[model samples]
Each structure stands twice: as structure tokens, then as C-alpha cells.
Target: MPQFSLYEEEYHPSPLKRTWIEFRNSHIAVVGLVVLAGLLLFSLFAPFLAPYDPLAQNIDGLLIPPSWTVNGSISHLFGTDALGRDVFSRIIYGCRVTLGSSILLVLLAMLIGVTIGTVAGVMQGVRSSVINHLLDALMAIPTLLIAIIIVAIVGTGLVNSMWAITLALIPQFIHHTRSFVRAEMKKEYILASRLDGATNRQLFFNSILPNMIEMLVVQGTLALSIAVIDISALGFLNLGAQPPLPELGAILADGLDVAYLAPWNVALPGLTIFVMVLAINIVGDGLRSALRKRLVR
Candidate 1:
């Protein structure tokens, strides 16, 4: 009793507070962020960073596996495709095509879906019911099948493929945002703000929408993973990213012949897509958790 433990204050920080800090400073979250940043950078700079043209082939080098040539040279570090193009370079460049189109589609879908959802959520009754049903029906359809149908009808080009993916993605955002906004509108803060003679537009834009921003941020991150998967499936089916374009799915399809013989060609691109999607999902989960904590605090 006489010796008041002076070290107690330093040692006994609140567990909840420490947990919150740890979540913010967590290793998985940090590594996920780094991985995402690196992928983005690689995709953006692929044209300059890649050693050789992804499409150029040396038939003389056809099917040559990766090994140091006796003359102090190597044909392809990751081996050659059936056509003898450098697999390493193609896989690197393919990241740009895979991610770029998927991102554009997701953004477009978000813009359209979020706008519609926001408006629908602010309204009620028949309008909301109608909108909800429409979204539900769209969601019921398989995304992959829809992509196949749209591409078959529209003809596969980069623009068309993006449009197809965007169309498929919009239903999900529409449903999510509308639900979030509708519930947020019933909160006491929203009612109080309205009681103060805030205009409907003002209430929506200033009160409701701002509160929903954190949720939207989380949704966008999760949506990116879906977009990547959808695009890859489309590309694999030959419904997206036409020939001469270095697409991850198409590259994987081409590598199936000798995948066991020279594994890196297929492995590199598939791994890139898998890691990107996984990284996005992990970050999204962290963001959702963090945002909920922020709301509680």
C-alpha cells in the first residue's frame, strides 16, 4: 500500500483501446495494403516495365523451356508459349488488361447503381417496392450467364465487355445502397435534422448520404473482387478480351496444353488474379470492421 505501483499506469492500458489500436496497426491489413499498391503500380507501368513485347514471337524459340542457353543467354525466363512469345512478359502485361477493364466496369456500375439506389432509398412505398423487385430479378440471374448472353448479343470488344460487366454489377450496388440509405433515414439524427426544417434534398445530401459514405467505401472494395472474377471468367470463355490482347484468362487457356511441362506461364497470371482478388477482399473486410468501430466510437 505504501509503495503505489507507479508502473501500473504504463502497464494497464484498457484492453478495448489496445484492441482497437491493434486492429488499426494489424500486420495483415498493412500487408494487404502494400500488395494492392504494388499490383496497381505494376499494372500501370507494365508497358515500360515489361522486358519484351507480350505478343512478339520467335518461332525458333518455340516451346523452349526455361534454362540458361549454353551461349550465356536465355530465351525466356518464364519459358515460351506455344507461339514462342515470352510468357513472363505476357503475364506482366496481362495484369494491365485484366485489372484496367474490370475497374472501369465496376466504377461505371457504381456510379449508375449508387445514383439510382440513393434516389430510391430516399423515396418509399410503391417506388421502393418496384425498384427492389427489379433489382431482385436481376440478381437472381447468374452473373456469368448474363455476361455470356450480353457478349453474344453485343459482340466482344473491350468497350462491350466493360459494358456487360457493368450491367451485371449494377444490381448488387443498387440493392445494397438502397437498403443502407433507407435504414439510415429512420435514425434519430435524420428525424431531428428534418424537424429543423431541413429540405428533403438537404436532409438526403447532408445528413443521410454523408453517414452512408463509409459503407459505400467498403462496398466498392468488395465489388472490385467480384468484377475481377467476372471478367476472368468471361475472358476464359472467349466472351471478353479478344485475341492479340494479353488477358489473364486467355493466357491460362493457352497454357493448359503444357501447364505441367512449363507451369509458370499459366501460374503467373492466375496467381496475379487470385492474389489481387484476395487482397481486395481482405482490405474490404478490414475497412468494414474499422468503419463499424468508428461508428460505435
Candidate 2:
């Protein structure tokens, strides 16, 4: 062992630093991060990046193939849709709608779920049991079916679709959080805090919440992928984004009619959705691994 002087100190990595280091070390995670960041930047700058208005119709250019194809123009690089909107431009703009709604849905679900789950976990007796049973019943239903039912009840639209998806997802977060909280409640440190006159609120806010951050982050990211899929599925079903809006799934749906003549229209949006969901899942997995290692250290 090395002798330490009064001024000497042992080094320990901060949480942020460790997290970054771990994330950077994961190749899949790094790639996912880069792709996601690029998409976010592209979405943010869609108005500037897109050469043409995504919604603008060019009737003369309808069914045009990609730029490299015989009848295609460089102006519509990824080709034109049935309505003659530039596929590339629509894709760029659609990113904002798809990612934005998914993120908002996740945030809402997390806020509501975590609060209810924590309360259910902390409280004793019949209330907790009732809450648990309710959550379990919700979870037993397929998320897509639940979303469809909610959407049917509330009517169809982008906002309503997201709300439906959010409702479907809440049970998952609540179950996860409740399990973690219940386990944490039985730990020795929690008992000691209680013995030291710490209020339930104080123990929760100060002690429990901090430890739950890693789990929440991982869950939130994984939820994002599912949310994206659900959003796209709803859009595909004509229950989201609607006509003239250029959402990814709606774009793909529109492309179906002219798919044979204009394959790029469908392919581009489908590929974008696939890449987006894949990146999110990869990042989520990386976070889970990296956070677990940090906890071990």
C-alpha cells in the first residue's frame, strides 16, 4: 500500500465521467448515440435541411424514382411520393413528429407511473394490494390492444394516439418501479433511516429516489423504442398523424399504393423507422450494462 500524505487523496470517478467512459467504450452504444444525435440534429434543422417543403405537392413529378433513376430529378433525391412530395424532405420533417411524440409520451408515463408505483410500494394493507392487482391486470393485456382500445374510446388523431400509447405503457413502468421500491424499502439502510426519525417522504426523496435513477434511465430508454413502434403502428393504421402530415408510418402507408413504381418511397421511411428503433434499443442496452458496472464498482 502506498503511504498518503495529508494532501494526498485517492481518485474516484464521478458518475457522469464514469457513465461517459463506459458508454464510449461500447461500440454498438457509441454508434447508436451518434446515429440518434444525427437524427435529432436533422429533425431540429428540418426546415433548413430539406430542400423542398415536405408537404408541397409537385403534381408534375408524381411517381418519380430516386435521383439516380432514369426519370428522377436531383431536386427530389430520394424520389417523390404519390402526391409528389419529396420523400427525403418528408422523412427529415417526420423525424420531429415521430421522436417528439415518443419522448413526450415516455416522460408522461414515467411521471405518472413512478409516483403511483412509489406510493403503492411504500403504503401497506389493502390499498397496495388493490393497486398491484390493477397494474397487473393492465399489464396482462397486450400493449397494442390496450392502445387500440383507448384510441377507439378517445377517437383517433396524433395526440390521442400518443395518449393511448402512454396509457398502455404506464403499467410497465409502474410495475418496474413498484418492484424496485418494495425491495428497497426492506433494506437495512432504509430501516436505519426510519429509526433515525426520517419521515417517509424524506427517506423516499433523499434515499430511495437516488438509487432508482439508473433503473429509471434504462427503463425509459427501452420504453422509447416501444413508443416509437407504437406510434408508427398507429400511424400505419390511419389513427395517427393523418393525411398531409408526413409522419414516417403514414408516409410508408401512402407509399403502399405506388410501391411497385416507387419503391424508394416505402423503403426509405421503413428503413428510417427500423434504424431509429434499433438505435434506441442499443442505447438502452448499453446504459443498462454501463450502469450495472458502475454500481458494482
Candidate 3:
């Protein structure tokens, strides 16, 4: 029994031991997850914790250096924008816009892209041929440029902007998801499951989707980062998040003019964009690294 116990221990790890080993091997991934979680928590609690009304004007406090000075105050730690809105307050609120738009855009794009990609990748013959040609044409056009053009034509508002960005992202998602699905479809287990009387839905849910989940996770993270950055670029170009919404990109673009002096005006938004995008990218990197290690082990 003692010898058997040792053998069992070697053959099967306790859950805690498995988790500890995972943690030790994926330290950077853990840090990324922590940063991502922290930012998400901050965004969720912004309304309750913000010091001043993000939209309220305080010309008296405009662009004040962070307090602890004779004339300065701490109410607005990040200072104020041109209209005297509390920069700190607005920044906290600004995240709502950035993160919300990012999530919405990523989700919408993923749904459309993944569905099409699956259909295309699974079908061989005229179905895939037609889909592949269309995707190729769209891929040939520059995503950002096409996004800007579409936004300009459709008129600029949140809905229109989301549509434009979603359009920009659709091709990439289709390409990636199609490739992933196609590859998974060819795997022996998938073919075996199909031969063993699995329904289409079951094949997708139990076989294909489960296998592609890790790749999809990585794709979604990377896609969100790209979508957010693309949306911000459109905003900077004055196409998305039109005036009065406190968009991070427009704030930074406006900040560029006065960048010589009140650098924080732009810096605040720029930093927010940077950190949000950076958090997403970090998460993506971590996922990729973890997945690779998983493959190795």
C-alpha cells in the first residue's frame, strides 16, 4: 500500500499541486491576469469612486498641477481639461467609453466572424470557394482606411462607428476562425466523432468548438486590443465618439495642440488608452505563452 500510494502520487497530481505548478510555470501570465482584473474592477467602480463630476466645469481648477501646493487642490488629481472638467474624474469616466466600445465591438465582430468562418471552413466545394474569394477581396483593402471611409460615408455616431470598426475587424476574424475551424475539422477525433453518429451541433459544440477554444481565447484578446486601438484612431481622426462623450482618443488628439504646456490633458487620455490597450495585449501574450507551454508539456 505504501509503494502504491507513491506510485499514485507520481501518476496523478492533487488539484492544488497542479494549480501550483501551473502558477509557477506561468508567472507572466498571472501578472497579466492581475493587471487585467484590476483595470476591469476600476472601470466597474468608476461612478462611485470618482472625486468630481467628470463633466462638471471648474475653470478655477483647470490644469492645476496635482495638489499639496499653496494654491493647488487635490479634488482633481489629474487636473482639468480645457472646459475645466476634472481630468481625473473624466479619466475615470473615460474608461467607461473606451472599455465599453472595445467589448461591444469585439463581441459583435466575433459573432459574425466566427459564424461565417465556421461555415466556410466546414464546407468544401462552391460554398468555401465563394466565401474565400469575398474574404480575400476585403482583406486586400486596408482595414483602417476602409473603416475611415465607411465612417465618413455613413456619418459618425456610436452606432455607425461601431459598425465601421466591426466591418474592419470582420475579415481578420473570418480568416483566423476559418483557419482554426478548418484545421480542427480535419483532426482524427473530429472525423471519428462524425463517423460515430454525432450531429452537426454536437460536432460543433462537443468536438470542434471545445478544441478551438484556446485559439479563440487568444484571438479574442488580441482582436479586442486591435479594435480598441482602431476605434481610438477613428476618434482621433474625428469619426468616432463625437463631442461631449469624453473619448480617450479625441482627448489625446486635442491634447496634442496644447501638448507644449498642459501635457497632462493629452497625457491622461493617452495613458488611459495606453494602459487599457496594454492590459489587453498583456493578456493576449500571457494566453499565448500559457497555451504554448501547455502544448510543450
* Candidate with the larger lDDT of 1 and 2: 2
lDDT by residue (tens digit), candidate 1, 1-297: 588775756455454454356456767876887898887887899988788899998888776666553422264676777888887788787888888777788888888988888899888899889989998999999776777789889998666777888888888888998998888888998899888999878987888777666767788888888888888877777778876788888887778888886676677778888998998888888777766665565
Q: How much is 19 displaced in model 2, in angstroms?
A: 1.9
lDDT of 3 by residue, 215-247 (tens): 777889998888778778888888888767777
In order of listing, the candidates' clash counts read 0, 0, 0
Cα error, candidate 1, residue 131 (Å)? 1.3
Instruction: Give me the displacement of residue 12 in model 3, in angstroms.
Output: 4.8
Candidate 2 Cα RMSD after full superposition onto the native fold (Å):
2.7
Best by lDDT: 2
Top TM-score model: 2
CA-lDDT, candidates in order: 0.80, 0.90, 0.78
Query: TM-scores of the models, in the given order?
Result: 0.86, 0.95, 0.89
Candidate numbers, best lDDT first, in rank order: 2, 1, 3
For model 2, the run of ten residues with the poorest summed lDDT: 2-11
Residue pairs in steric clash, candidate 1?
Answer: none
